[model samples]
Target: MYISAFPTFSFSKLIKRKKAQVFSDYFGYENTRFFYRGAYAIFYGVKALGLKPKDTVLVPAYHCGIEINAILKAGINVKFYDVTHELEVDIESIKSNIDEHTKAVFVIHYYGFPQEMVSLNKLCQTHGLKVIEDCAHGLFSFYKSKSLGAWGDISVFSFQKSLPTADGGAIVFNDRKEDCFITQKKPALLTTLRAYLLLYSEHIHMFKGFLFSVFNTLILKPSRFILKILKRGGSKVITANTNEFDAQYVSLGPSGITEKLIDSIDAHGIVVNRRRNYQHLLEGTKHIKNIKLLFNNLPVGVCPLFFPIRVNQRDLMQQYLSDHGIETFIFGKKLHNLLPKEQCPVAWAYSDELLCLPIHQDMNPGNIEYILKVLEDENCPLN
Candidate 1:
């Protein structure tokens, strides 16, 4: 069976869940609000910020297009900024782009590594611009002593990426003074069922391989139709890791089951295991000639979302990994056409060369070692 990028469903967690009364206590954050997906959180958060129509928000060029969609849907104008080839935000580029009309700076913590928040916060403070931390890859991630979600004016999280939940996204207000609320009805039953089935097939070992694929392909279309009839999360079947945004469902909230599923996650175990796997690969791949590690050192307090690498040939390397029963992701290759044609060369290069490796909590040392060997193989010409 092929390994997945994020941890899959574990029935063990569902077997032991907290009651509704303690749901608030589980996350331990008083100002956190849940949504159907990260894009919804972005949409609502931008709205709540009280920006006027066509007010510009600065965004990274190497971004998931769905985020750009959410901002556009919120009636906000977007200005792209360059991020270094190493995936670090270009502070100078950002400073140069800020204008009187720019109301906010959207900072994405690419692959759970927190951006230089102190510097960013200081820069934003001088210009009176609100900072929105896109922590979609950064649940339980910390920058120095402070947490990623707590550093920005508004922060967004995706439990669907970090946990076993079928669907969940959250917006957290860093400043307790800012009060915002969102209420959404539970998704349709068919939508929830389809999500669970997909999770089971992907995450559960017993259900892996061709049979699961056959089942999903056969039932997905019909399930989507039933979902549309039932008015679920959306009319379409929105799978995880989708490249495009589904604007129709931007207003929807999370399923009722997500609340319970999220509580059962072991945050510490996830961090420890993922870090171990990442460090393992980082150390082993240092000598390879054809690729470059995005972040060479795992910093203290940082929880990585994936092992991002820049390969000489992304498509060929991805196929090489897939043939060995390993899966890889081309994170954010689909740039929005709306971005200016001439700007952001570094981000454009990254979109083509960058490949995301699976280093989820589910992977063991053997699994990580196998992945390393594949990349470091002398016989394989990944370049």
Candidate 2:
């Protein structure tokens, strides 16, 4: 039984008709605009913030390259800020980078752990730089008593990453002056059709059997491939969130199905189950001498996105886990051209070493134990 990093969808979630629900309270935003992907949310956030062309913004060296693309699409210039091996922002690096043209500072709360927002916010305020929090991983996370997304001038969230939704993204504006709702055209029907197929594939993947794995590898992969060749721009649906940036898809909003799926979610249960799964991984890996857990303690109110670990043989370990029916992720190993690998050694090293294991709400205790046993395999070459 492979444990996926993201949640598997249920047919019940798709067919049931529910009343339209507002998620402002859950996401800590009074208003939000949904998009087809997280990159679009960021794209519009820059526009809403009035960041003009050639206006520089400080961004973390540790990032998904798509964000850099979104900023560039908005015609904004980007400067790099270093992040520590422990995934914390280097405040001094950020301070040194801020200059006359810098209009905003982009902050990413990697793996749903909140950064030192108070310190970072103070520094941004000192230079009068607007803070754009990238809470793509921090949807249900908190820093002290405040939610991760609430602290920024504007925040970007990805429902696809954290929720069981097929495709969705959102932007929350803290400053009402920049708060304007957008009415983006609905995603294409072909896109919506692919979303359903992918969702069902995820549901089928939740079943524990070699037959299921074969079905996923054979049926789902081929179906998606054929969809790519037959439909218009279907390849983007498969590769939407990878390192590559697609300008053509930037203006699109989420499908109606995505909105309905989000409305059906149990927000509190997501946080609880994710936190529990995180602790299971934490406990399982705590005693291992060969690797280091990037984050050891789960703070109160923080919903962990994954269990990040550092090892010399990251690529090998990821393949090993995949072979054993567990999915692992490597976070943002590709550095954008704006921030070369040579300039940010720490972040580059982290990009190479960090492997994110699944801790989503979908996995049961049995699933957790199986993943742990694989991690502790003595025969494994990667120590």
Candidate 3:
């Protein structure tokens, strides 16, 4: 079976409850503010803080474009900061970009690799800028003993991305005090409907993975119009581009389901399995010439979302892997280009060469060996 970089959920217990009941049991809550998704969490965070329009916010040039939209939706101007070759934000560029108008800095922990938060926090303090850590990709990740989300003045985590939740986001404030904004009572009906639908979708996907892949690759590939419509409707809200910030806030339900799921995952040793698979990939491909592994160690504390490799022939290697049923990803393909050609030169270079390879919980040592062998046979310069 082909491995996916995305996280999976096991919902056998969730499937037993009525969708409405599940929503009420899991989503509705007091003492917590909610939004449609993470982007809205960001939107509300900025609004709740009462940031004025035209205030400048510094963001990594190479990031999910939706982040730009989120900042814009909050009526703030965004400035781009360059990223290092390792994909972390360039500290110097961040320092250079700071000015009186700079009110906040949003940092993305790319691919679950925690950025140098200590330095970033110091930088923010020096400039009197508030920090918003976008933990959409770095949920549950830590920097030293501190959590990534905890470092920022305000932080947001996308439960949809890291957790198995259908759609949810949470905002943590620096002072841990609740501030006033447009708030709402939890939507029990919607929460229940979404949870059950997500649970059902998982089962359907597992049972018909091959069929779905065929339909998506073959049937959906040629139908750009249909795909566009589907894309617009299918949680496009999560992407930074879709701006529906003015929409009403709805509770993502609560932490009961997420806590249970996390407990179950721990009980089943999924984290260990994920780490072991990551280690297998790292060990298997350590000597691949012209391909540099971003980190020297098996990434710990922050579970790697994918095993990323920077290769000279990234596009070719990706095709080579795909042809052999070993899937790969080209994350942030147009990241730097989206900013400006000459603005972030190193980020542009890194974007072209980086390829994220599969290292999910589903893969085994045999799978890792097979992928390595295929690369070796293809004259992929395995040292």
lDDT, candidate 3, 1-383, per-residue tens: 44444444556633433323311222223323544467777877777666899898898887656667767777888889988877788999988988888998989898778999998899888888899888877665667867667788888766655445555666777645757655344435434344534444443454457576565565545554554665577633222123334344432333355534433433123345566777887777766654578766755676666777878888888877776767676666766234877888777776787788866555567767877787668455333
Candidate ranking under TM-score, highest first, comes to 2, 1, 3
Ranking by lDDT: 2, 1, 3
Candidate 2 TM-score over all chains jointly: 0.91
For each of the candidates, give the backbone clash count: 0, 0, 4
- Which residues of candidate 3, in runs, are more than 4 Å off? 13-34, 184-270, 336-338, 379-383
Candidate 2's residue-wise lDDT over 153-219, tens digit each? 9998988788877788889887774465565777777767777776667667667454676877888
Off by over 4 Å in 1: 16-27, 177-182, 205-241
**Candidate no. 3 TM-score:** 0.75
**Candidate 1 vs 2: which has more lDDT:** 2
Which candidate tops TM-score? 2
Task: List model 1 lDDT by residue over 144-177, tens digit each.
Answer: 8887887889888888776777888988877654
